[model samples]
Target: MNIVLIGYRGTGKSTVGKVLASRLGRTLVSTDAEIVRRAGQTIPEIVAKLGWDYFRDLESTVCQELAMRDGLIIDTGGGAILRSQNVDSLKKTGTLFWLTASIQSIASRIGGDTQRPSLTGTKSFLEEIQEVLTERTPKYQAAADHVVSTDGQSITQIVDTIQSCL
Candidate 1:
């Protein structure tokens, strides 16, 4: 079975995923990183050059591909769960773990990241996060088989919680 990590950008999915995969002796598959590697661009670059639909299409394809693999720890992009198809595909052979954090925590963790473009084009980062997260919270909740809070938690603590859940 695969262990899939889902949440917003700053929730430690990638970091915790790396440690989880190492502890479980599984391969780590970061959908965003893979997309970047394959497309020869960062996420912001992809969104800027091709648009959000194009990026989502690419994300869907990646989700479909990764869903077929076993013994992997998949770290999904923050917006992966926005599409029901992506969520369904990832959950087919994977245990979905939604890593959650307060808006303040996320703001603090990824306040000035340039790699990811803003989903809401006209808003400030904090404003965008508040709005986007308000809409995405229910989707994330529905997608997750387990929900773990990452706020004020260390990488080791988060990994331990996920492992215990598994």
Candidate 2:
């Protein structure tokens, strides 16, 4: 079975997905990384040039493609759950694991990565994170078959929790 990992930014989706894939002997795929690669630009560059709507469309398309594959550990971007169709597709593909972390924790984890192209000039840093998390919570909850909190958890513990959930 496939394992689709979804969560807020900096929730360790990518890192945990990689670790889970290795432990489970499954291939790993990150929707955000794939979007960046296919767009032939970094995420910031894509958002700057093509716009978030454009990027999100690309993300949905990529999410669908990856969701169809089997025996893969897929890590999706935080906002991937915003669209119900995306959630429907993901649910049909495999088990969904929502990785979660506190807003402060997420901020510390991501830590000024310019490549992320998040709410840099739009709002206060803390407000931006909080806003995004608040908006996405229901969407994430709606999509999850399982939820795993990464806050105060070691990577091994996170991975172990995910395994147990599956």
Which candidate wins on TM-score? 1
Q: Which number leads on lDDT?
A: 1
For model 2, the stretches where C-alpha displacement exceeds 4 angstroms are none
lDDT for model 1: 0.93
All candidates: TM-score = 0.97, 0.96
lDDT of 1 by residue, 1-166 (tens): 9999999989899899989988989999999999999899998889989999999999999999999999899999999999999999999999999999998999998987888887999998889999999999999999999999998888999999998998
Model 2 per-residue lDDT tens digits across residues 56-77: 8999998888878888898998
- Predictions in order: lDDT: 0.93, 0.88
TM-score of 1: 0.97
| 10 residues in a row with least lDDT, candidate 1 | 109-118
Q: Candidate 1: how many backbone clashes?
A: 0
